[model samples]
Target: MSGGADLPGAAHLVLADGVAHLDLETAVFNAMLEGWARQQATRFLSSDGTIQPRISLVRRFASFTNEYPWQWDSADVEEFINHLRARRPSFAVSTGRGYQNILRLFCEYVTDARYGWPRKCYEHFGEAPVQILHEWNTVTHSSDYEGSPGRRPLTYDEVQGLFDAADGRVEEIRKRRRKGALAAMRDSILLKSVYAYGLRRREAAGLDVADLRRNARMPDYGRFGALFVRYGKSSKGGPPKRRTVLTVPEFDWIVDALDQYVDEVRPLFQPGKHPALWITERRGRISLRRVDEAFETARKVAGIPEELDLHCLRHSYVTHLLEFDYPERFVQDQVGHEYASTTAIYSGVSDEYRNRLLHRSLKGRHSALWGHCFD
Candidate 1:
């Protein structure tokens, strides 16, 4: 069982176990290893249906078998990472990070306890990968993207414009309710609430119409409460909390949409079942795939030609909250992000803003009569 000699691979496991086992490529092996570790050590597991991501990480790192501990030296890692960079897949940094991270796990799983981080490892992955992750800045990592300069928040006017446009879309779509778009509008309102009031996507998608009902939790989440989604990607292991800032009018729109879908639409869609708030027309409860497609359809309808997905709604939430003068920690709380408050995202200043501050510092420096040291 030492040094990957007994590591289970499809080609070899059945040789001893007498059953044809699923193939475990290096990436897949790492995934199962980590999942075992988490269960044994931390009780950590993703919500139902986490296999897709595990599979995705596997397929992306398929060639790791060739990068043996010895062959994948400093230069090999550098070349591999550079090759990954050139491909520039939307998730390139992620893919490269994935490759290294998974391989690191593999080394942990298979390497003898006696042989530690290779002398070459420090030279190649300096400061250790963990430290690099602790200090990495996404902006610097992605500086090569075309026109990905520090994107500023939309002005108040633009914010209002987005709201107005969303509202207009709702009104127009209202006329076409026969198209079963009440579900679409319901989802749009949910997305808008998340963007405007800062609901995490999973929480938003997980909302039950019942969750928003006054006295729904029997005075626990409180009347006129926002539903808290806590178990998914955004907030892991923490008790969920509702937003206290939603205005009655703003909250009402989401409530109205949910009500319409449940009373008129949901019955037509589902004769007698409702486990989740976002239900499909026929199935009673919508899957994550259905929720995502709803978002995609609405994005196209709203004329946002670019890749406007859930994460953009989240980014929009964070950026707009900053413009609205919400404090760094407060916005972080709303979004359920742990490290973002200290990291650049919380109070991340734009380079342009930093330069402007530098200019102001110059003015202060020269404000003294001779530009000498201030008394």
Candidate 2:
């Protein structure tokens, strides 16, 4: 009502208080999304997986509060987060923190002056968007590792049971002349591969035949001597990191397993041109979901605890390698950790391992004190 000139957009009919019409409010919202899309794109994030989720979170927050970003305040964030916490199967600390961080990033993007979202909001709504969520109002980072306390590395017996269960499933299917015998066999090897190499689910799913490499020192093992992991976890805006994990002596039996699967069984999948190491029955590459499903099936058969997951295999790998007296830095590099501390956090070494370390220290101290040495 105060403006003299008629604007071209749908919200040209402005109120005396300078608040935007509904259509203009919608348009500003769309523009905010567009700006966020460009920002994420510039940083090389996937539109569907990364940017869209953030957009949906903002939309869900707005729906919860019945308030647009321009009207949101710290209290709204607090209430919505509280609601999340109160819901059944409440968000874990890590998950809650992730959602809080996503909201904070969106607020930062919208309020940044260079993006012009704040300026446009002010012109249309008589107020600009503000950074509503702050550290005081949201979850704070307390530790590098904040996963469930119940989640832990599988012990040696548990790992052995899991592998035996997987192998047993393959035999059972084959005995019954079932259609899934080959698939079951593949799953058996897949789960072992995940633990043998300390692979994340995605990394195992993304493997290709060519990713298997020969180590000159371990030529007897041939192509199964090392794994070239091209899908190691990425940084915030970076492509997946790459690493070559040499076959450790403890898990060397994996070489025979891989040789059998690759030479004899993989061709049965009829994956002609597909180079993926793990092929589905449909002759396509295995997905990350399938990797988890395989691990879960084996876990249940092995009677492992329900809380343990595919990731626990990786944890088991780290812990077991340490138990074997492998150098800490060697284990870190094998797992493709960016820092030694990150590798350290994954370690949940068994009590037996600690006891062995204590015994070794006592024996060494006795050797220093006495004339004779004990083996």
Candidate 3:
């Protein structure tokens, strides 16, 4: 074909040419995956995290079906989904939907006539691949928030206990002359910063010293007045979203904590010229796994429920901000949520806050009847 190399997915190229008899099917399947990877890369999907998992999922689906793309049908898709549901500790609804979406995307790529996969399959196997995942068969996104029910905002007391536990770890390490005191201190500040700024794990880990910015209005806080988050979650096939999370007055304690870490504690690690806000013992950037481990350790020490993860700190931030009487739009912007509805989902305001709100409403509307009661 003309301009074969110029095709979106390199669909004009033959992949299974000169393959051994027993390896032909495998070679063709591998080629299809490679082509898909190329296409996704062209669209700016991350190879390390996004494209690899997609290719792996396609391989898994193929393995389950025990058939090539041309032989895959609606029954295969349904059966595979049923198998997923039947497994011990079955996948979450959102996870199942995500799997189906990936499979559907792969099917769309292979069945498109312009991609030449369909024509190639027909020539090789006497049948073209058809899209197996359909609207009726696939999982529907029925819920706005499909995350784990166990993952809710921590109560105010719980947030305090968690932070105290993290601080205690630092103290314990220092008392025992443990090697990880610096790391413990970093972990303590990291967890606090996560909640203080309503940061996702990656966003916090991806932070550099330069990300700390000054707010013109909040000069007292100096460079800690705002966080320039460059690693906000990305949309499909897009760069990471960026936002500036302004330091709110309620969480202004973070300013001093961050200042001490940046000025005094971090220098002990000898992270010479490393721009990372959080550094490891080896003077490298702290990893995401380390962040999780830190939170898990503190959670256990604090006797918090096992279900509450690092992300719960983020939920707590949203909830606590709402409780502190911040506007919903302000909370939404702080957390980098695209919609106020998403901010609402993260918020689990305390019963005390709700009761106070109710009392205020009643006192405002029926001062004669409710004013004395509130007092």
Q: Pick the candidate with the highest TM-score.
A: 3
Which of the two candidates, 1 or 2, achieves a greater lDDT against the reference?
2
lDDT of 2 by residue, 21-48 (tens): 5687776776676667666777888777
Q: Give the winner by lDDT: 1 or 3.
A: 3
- Cα lDDT tens digits, model 3, 1-375, are 322345667555646345466676777788889888988989898888799999999999999999988899999988888898888463788888999999999999888777788777777889988988888998888889998788899888898999999999999999999798989999999999999999999999999999999999999999999999999999878999999999999999999999999999999999999999999999999999999999999999999999899999999999999999999998899899998898999999888999999988988889886577767
Candidate 3 accuracy as TM-score: 0.94
lDDT of 1: 0.48
User: Listing every candidate in turn, what is its Cα RMSD in Å to the true structure after a full C-alpha superposition?
Assistant: 9.3, 4.8, 2.2
RMSD in angstroms between candidate 3 and the native structure over all alpha carbons: 2.2
My TM-score estimates for the predictions, one after another, are: 0.59, 0.91, 0.94
lDDT of each: 0.48, 0.86, 0.90
How many residue pairs clash in each candidate at the backbone level? Answer: 0, 0, 0
What are the clashing pairs of model 1?
Answer: none
Q: Specify the poorest-scoring 10-residue window by lDDT in model 1.
A: 129-138
